[model samples]
Target: MREPRIGIFGGTFNPVHIGHVRAAIEVAEALGLAGVEFAPAARPPHKSGDPLLDFALRLDLCRAAVSGIPGFSVNPLENERPGPSYTCDLLADLARTRPGEQFCFIMGMGDLLCLAAWKNGLGLGRLAHLAVHARQGQELEAFGRFLDHNAKAMGAAPTADPAVWSLPQGRLMQYVPVARLDVSASDIRRRWQEGKRIDGLMRPSVLDKLLTHADALPAGWGRPPAA
Candidate 1:
């Protein structure tokens, strides 16, 4: 029997939207995972796009978003650990703490493409498996080329299945395909700020909490200040 495995999905979850939740669901289903832990970043190294809410609030939103969802839970490990949260570090810690369970670090193909730039990216397989998901219209060929070029670098070889690659530390990197959910946190925040209906973009519970704290949102989200 295969060793029981769980998945770790790390992100700002800047108010975990439906897209984020749905993608995680797809990856979990595809990989037959025991559960997926949504770990919100306490301090991100990048993100010049938009200002974020307090880590506490973001963590609250993530918990609220996944609340009552089967096989999904929030992990606050990043919050406990000071300094910028990196994937390799998080997975390494998980590997140390959870000796009996295997872990799959979940991420998007875009992130996979930028792995080399991430802190300790290449060494991730030593820590845990990587389940990278991609949306339609993405360049799978590029990913294929990436797998081909890095096969030696990762000390991995192709399996009978083209999409799965072996990694040095008894880990695997597989490409998962998920439906294109045209939803994004930036778009959701912009909609909320623009005074538009964002009813269906996220879980209703999440919307409720966001509205409950609507006044707390940054003005830069596009909401004009009161005159």
Candidate 2:
């Protein structure tokens, strides 16, 4: 039997916009993944905000965004937890809980560039295969060289380790290009703040909810709800 392929794409899902959905869908297809889970970070270590919508509301927005999508679901592991969401911790739990399944931690090239700085970065090579998406012209050579330089110093790793070291000594990595989109949650928030139309910027369902619940969000974010 073939191993179940799972891709974990975690983020704040601040508004669960269309760009995020596109990326998830594209990566899942590119990697031939059985399913892709969007894990919203409960409290992202790298970000500070009013959380515009409370946790439950944010989760609800996420659920609404992917309502009819196939092979896509939200994993609340990070959302339910209180502290900062660390990728290593999440991967480890996934490895143990789903022993037989093959897991890939999906990320953008920007994140890959800073992977070495993440907690337990070296151990990540052993936790799950790293799947990164890049834009058409984004150079990945630096990342490749970084991995090549550290594969050995990192010691024996996991998941296709043998193949990893076969590449240049400092380039132990695999990359796949996925569709790129201009939509960003930050931009969405900014547009909302300016009272700009967000049509076609997010999933229809999510947009509706955002419009309906605009009253519940923090002041100065997006458009204010009708008086």
Candidate 3:
């Protein structure tokens, strides 16, 4: 029997919101993943500045968001080590610690495009599969062609499966289609600052944590100018 495949979805969950949760669900179903692990970044090399919540609090929100959700949980592995938390290192660590299981690093099309710039980025396929999910405002066919072009450049042979691209590094890059939501973390934060109703934007449990620690959020994310 094939080993169980797990989806490793890492991100700066400034505060885990609905879109993040829902997308993970859809991606899990699409890829037949056993579960999705949400790993919050301790210090994202790409991200720098305020309004990014403290690591502990962001970790708390991630825990709340996935609490009691079947086949969904949080992984604090990124915070386990010092310095910038790179996906390559995360996947390698998981591979080393958890044997007999296949891991697919879940990311969006944008991340895939930027993968080459990441630390040990090109070698990610050697560690595990790359699952690139859909995003809004990007042409699917164009992106598919782009992936094909990239795969060719890497000297990876083509497969009959259109959704799966086999990398020469002996792993795969999969394109997963997921439902797109109009919501985002920035919008959610903005609404909160404006005292807008954010009832359906996330789980009640997550909202509870957000409200309790809201004062810790950067003031720049607070209140908008009067119209």
Candidate 4:
């Protein structure tokens, strides 16, 4: 019997938006994942300077955003764990709990470019496949080169195809194409702070919830206006 394929989609998800939902759908479909778990980080090691929304609020928004979506659910592992949330640790925990399942870490092109900089990034491939989502018109030649170098390091023959690469320890790296959305969480927050409309950027349920609790957010959660 074939092992169940699962995609791990992790993010701060300060307020889950449509762009995030769309990317998850695209990646899950492209990779034929049995399900996609949206893991909200309790404290992202990479993100500093600004404070994130409360973990409970972020998880609630995520749940609302993915509601009714087949094969989509929110995972609060990071929130429950102590200390900084690292992808490597989460991957390891998932491997331990879900043995015999094929795990894929879904990320964006920007994240792929900085994978090596991540905590224990080199060993991440061994824990799960890297499913990178390439936005429309984004140049991926650099990513392809990085994958090729890793493939060669793993003693695997490099291929011309940039979509998939063989890695050490029975892992794989795949690039999945997805529609580019100009929306970003920072931008969404900024718009909200400035009393601007963010109609299409996020789900109505999420936006409504945020609106209902706007007063509770930290002071100046969004970026400050340019000088």
Per-candidate Cα lDDT values, in order, are 0.83, 0.71, 0.80, 0.81
**Residues 1-227, candidate 1, lDDT per residue (tens digit)?**
76867989989887689989989999999989899999998888977456788788788888888899899999999988878888878887887887878999998887888888889887787788888888855656776888787766667688888778888767888888889999988787777666678899889988888788877776435554454
Model 1 stretches with alpha carbons more than 4 Å out: 136-138, 219-227
- Top lDDT model: 1
Please give the distance, in angstroms, between residue 48's alpha carbon in candidate 2 and its true position after superposition.
Answer: 3.2
TM-score on alpha carbons, each prediction: 0.92, 0.82, 0.88, 0.90
Model 1 residue 27 distance off true place after TM-score fit, in angstroms: 0.8
By summed lDDT, the worst window of 10 consecutive residues in model 3 runs over 218-227
lDDT sort, best first: 1, 4, 3, 2
lDDT of 3: 0.80
Task: Summarize candidate 3's per-residue lDDT along 108-205 as a digit string, tens digits.
Answer: 77777787788977678778877888864455675567666665445455568777778754667777777777778878878867767788888999
Better of 1 and 2 by lDDT: 1
> What's the true lDDT of residue 102 in model 4?
86
Query: RMSD per prediction, one decimal?
Result: 2.0, 4.3, 2.7, 2.9
- Residue 131 of model 4: what lDDT? 86
lDDT of 2 by residue, 75-194 (tens): 877765557788888888887777777777787777866777878866675777667677645555654666666667555332453223332222223566656688888787877666
User: Candidate 3, which segments miss by more than 4 Å at Cα?
Assistant: 135-138, 152-155, 168-170, 219-227
